[model samples]
Target: MVRRANPAIQALKEETYIMSAVFDHGEFDHHEQIVFANDHQTGLKAIIGVHNSFLGPAAGGVRMAPYARMEDALTDVLRLSRGMSYKNALAGLPLGGGKTVLIGNPRTDKTPALMAALGRAIERLNGRYLAAEDVGMTLADMEQIATETSHVFGRDPKAGFGGEPSPMTALGVALSIRTCVRRVLGRDDLKGVRIGVQGAGAVGADLARQLGEAGAEVLVADVDPARAQAAASAAGGQVVGVGDILFADVDVLAPCALGAVLNDETIPALRTKIVCGAANNQLAEPRHGLALAQRGILYGPDYVVNAGGIINVAYEVSGTYDAAKVVEHVQRIPRTLEQIFEEAADEGLTPDVIADRMAQRLIGRS
Candidate 1:
């Protein structure tokens, strides 16, 4: 007698083949759900990835960029959502990881109607995921999203109960930098330390200002010349060219902009002893963490150090947003980094590797 293939197994195999054909599996970490949203009337094309929901509802900011292809957008959402899970788990937040990527040039393609349509898409998730502000998004955009879905956070302040999280994120990065300085440079302060900040956005500029006020000589750069100048002025620092900031002879290189900046070509050119900033998905690949370690550069894992924004937003969900409480919570970042560093040293591994293990265990994936 001849046996036949199980019908369920055959169907799953076919589905897997179709997904592989459509998605770049390299970045498609075991996500729980992936939603492709299209609205012809508003021209809204978006992808939402939920990596985990074991802790609670998935939460992450909404990012809009002019991605050349939908495949690139899908890869971005997958990696970002996975990062969100690690970030929230390590931060001890009762939220899962997820992200939404809007495919368009925010400056040109975004409209109130488009934002409302995106909100409706989020509403259809029925609280499975929560959205907030991210790159190319602002409090106004989040407010517009909230108009359609009650699942949005990171809006403007309401009697200091809730507000934009960029500043809080900057504060956490600054603290983590200080922690790195203490561990590597054996210093209790940042006086006279030369720190290069790449990207002059809200968090970068604020971080530069804090670093400058702490007496570190700051070098800042942005793709936008005016924004770079503004960040420099605000920090009382100097502005470098975008290409030069990464290779600047500084004590630390803070990538506060986009992801995948620490990949192959850029790692060898780094002159800094430490890399810590507010950017998500900074490691182009997991191996880059080891590369940084091989170069004697102390790297504060991006998700671990840049978790302040999510922590701030989580408070609003609890209806217990307190300024002092938020600061106290953000301050925990350094302790977490210190733990990762200590364990990495003990195990002869990079901090990112240790961090990933710890986060995995926390999320019960281990």
Candidate 2:
């Protein structure tokens, strides 16, 4: 099937009633492709956004969410895919960025057939886009999709494939938080440094535990009470309510949950001296990063700070996979982040904008 590009599509952007109109608004200009996939038999309705592939074929994740509306899913994928492009650029990976989002209640609608349908949709992209597990997706789900197409990542380790990247991602985030502390807090140790974590999922839990073990005062909260309790227990920290996590007065605030948590309202409420997290798109918009900078808060660029997961997968994208090499690559994230911080300070630009410049330079796009 071929898509007809129409000049009139630009006018439709003003009509927010339609979701596809979002593409013509400016997203189409930033992205290389936006594909809507549907399979009636499997009931798979998904979208894949390939932001840029200047370095190589786009690589990101396949996410499934019970979004309230198709517009929500579209907004998420568009933002996430663009974030991946920056993530790759900052991580020094030779790959580009892309992401797939499946809209449905994962609890009931995600069947093996749906995974296969999503995989088939990816196959249609030929090798231009690769998929991995993200947010609501799992490694097992990626394996199921792998049955339909070879364009996937995060397979089981038993098959000599890369498994979940949460561990290394946690390591990278911890190191980044430390860098923030040293730069802004004027400290080299996290011991006795108060920290608040907003999310207790895989990466967040691991980050909390690591921080706790390092003698930091860690506080955590999650929408799921059980998860929050577990993470707090593992980290030897206290559990707070979801609403209180943002306003908690701490040296560093780590947001590990959803994107756009740093919008206008929350930025004003932030009491932390440094904002560093494992979440992507932490800023609701680019301006929010500048807002944080203007407030004298050190804001670690989300993509630059959280490149461990992508770095772990980038190893598999090239020649033979090496665990040691992947660990080395992920560990090097602190240096990359340090460079971003130094450059941002010297250039007097927000880390977000500076990191974007860094990425574009590497891919010859700057």
The models' CA-based lDDT, in order, is: 0.93, 0.86
Off by over 4 Å in 2: 1-22, 26-29
| Candidate topping lDDT | 1
lDDT of 1 by residue, 251-360 (tens): 99999999999999999989999999999989999999999999999999999999999999999988888878988999999999999999999999999999999989
Regions of model 1 farther than 4 Å from truth: 1-18, 21-24, 159-161
Q: Clash totals for all models, in order? A: 0, 0
lDDT string, candidate 2, 248-278, tens digits: 9999999999889999999998999999998
* Least accurate 10 contiguous residues by lDDT in model 1: 17-26
Q: Which candidate gets the maximum TM-score versus the true structure?
A: 1
TM-scores, in order shown?
0.94, 0.93
Candidate 2: Cα lDDT at 274: 94
